[model samples]
Target: MASPGERAGEPSDRGRPVNDVQLSKFLSYICRHGAEKKGLTVQEGGYINVDDILELREARKNGYSVSDVQRVVANYPKQRFSLRSKPNDDGKLQICANQGHSLEVKGLDLVPILRPEEAPVVVHGTYRRAWEQIKKQGLSKMSRNHVHFAAGLPGEDGVISGMRSSCQILIYIDMKKALEGGLLFYRSANNVILCSGDENGFISTKYFEKVYDITKGVKLDY
Candidate 1:
């Protein structure tokens, strides 16, 4: 499962073939964020019968099938979806997004992050255009369920966990201060950090220790 703060889907690279990528995006849209919008039934733990998803007009038009879904699950670099046998019904298999759910899914057995050592500082990557507002108002979950963070700092081993190529700014969070400030954090299966916002759905800028404008190659003190 994705960390509680993570959202499903990644920016699509233009040069890649569109069919499978589109199918993966469509799956993430419905499975992680918009099942009800499509009138698809989501069961407890956010599982949806594979056949039910395949019944969608778009799915049929695209020639999507169980094998296609399996391929997506197996090949998606993030491992965003997981497939399992229905509880007490070994004959049936169900699929669900590992995390990043906007829908009110019940009984999702998300694991908790109990050890502080496991996550030191959580990083958030965004475009520079949003930096001013974020500097003043802080990071908000927006329409999604949680404020997502990368498990580690950027440029570490040439891998920035939660970062997208579109991002030009990186926000480094003070996790210790955040926890001391009474914020709850969870780590998703893929090591993305997840946190539900306070009553107002925002994590104030006070928790951010540093902001780097990667495009400009400098850190903004403010």
Candidate 2:
């Protein structure tokens, strides 16, 4: 039988012949949601042992090696994951997804955006098709963990916050209203805004003060 490290295959500068997209999906699974399912232990800060992650059956099946994880952490366009030195062990390292987790990761130390000056004008992007429902119900986390927002509008220079290309509508959040309403917000390492939503998984429509149809020149008042 091949050793676990040998079975993981050799590392590559380009993250190997494995498709980058597939590898990313795999990482998102184990790092964010499937660690328990895969039998890997996640620490208080959501950090997982890199070696244990590499040993996962799913990871092995996908041909993921430690090097692939390192490369993805270093080069992924959005920087969706981060690595850190394990506590009390300077030489040891661990990794975790920066955000976008549906799992209830206890002790995840996300930085709070408390001061008004530190909180940017956050925006959420969606399609026009959902406008009526959103107007009635407000923005919800839907399936994933917290509600995700971008720091600002998508720029001409191709800086994508969290907006998808298919997003046709943009909702500007009134942070003042949210803060006053007692809703807390945190900024992920990748700069995505996350908030523990209400019981219905929504941030409530009241905070969505302005809506714009990017494809159209009109602003929606709701």
Candidate 3:
């Protein structure tokens, strides 16, 4: 069932004419960061229609096939549109909006309940904050990858080491409890925070810091 010009990864024949959804996916794959305000722009259906063609032609010249182009273009248009709708103060894409853009609390916009700057702090109290931070900062936010690098982990992607797997902690501590229990801290290795528990499942670094009074006993010679 193979046609002359059609192969597994090849584009449909020259005039095959892909359907809208397929075309949309293909177009998105072709020029992911569409226009970028200077690159591609949308004409309809949240898909790029014009300038992407130019980029596609260049890709073609560079030996990129229709299928290859289709993939990259397909995945990122909605993100671009969301970024375009509300750019950060610097006019750059707010790559973090997918993480609720720090604009809501309890899945509700908190504009009425809190000020702009205060919203982040309030949102930080929620369980989803860590993921929000991850999306906003990528591998740079908590210095996860960097810490892992410093700790001597290997490979291109950062490794995870703390508390078994994903380093996610679930705890609800009020101010009084925090003062008595102490805050947790971690050391890095290949962007990983290695952790261990004596007998309990997982212990908070803050608790260790407080119980040992480590922060107080240390003296800086310099």
Number of the top-ranking candidate, with lDDT as the measure: 2
Off by over 4 Å in 3: 1-34, 54-57, 65-222
- So what's the TM-score on candidate 2? 0.85
- The local distance difference test score of model 2 is 0.77
Q: Is candidate 2 or candidate 3 better by TM-score?
A: 2
Report, for every candidate in turn, its global Cα lDDT versus the true structure: 0.75, 0.77, 0.27
Candidate 2 deviant stretches above 4 angstroms = 1-16, 88-90, 156-160
Candidate 2: the clashing residue pairs are none
Residue range with the least summed lDDT across 10 consecutive positions in model 3: 118-127
Please give the TM-score that candidate 1 achieves against the real structure: 0.84
Sorted on lDDT, best first, the list reads: 2, 1, 3
**For every model shown, what is its TM-score relative to the native structure?**
0.84, 0.85, 0.21
lDDT of 1 by residue, 1-222 (tens): 332123224322322223567787889998888789889889888898787888888877666767667767777766678787767865566788866888888866566665567677678999978888888888998877788887765556423346665688989888777878888888766666788878888998888889888889999976
RMSD of each: 6.2, 5.8, 16.2
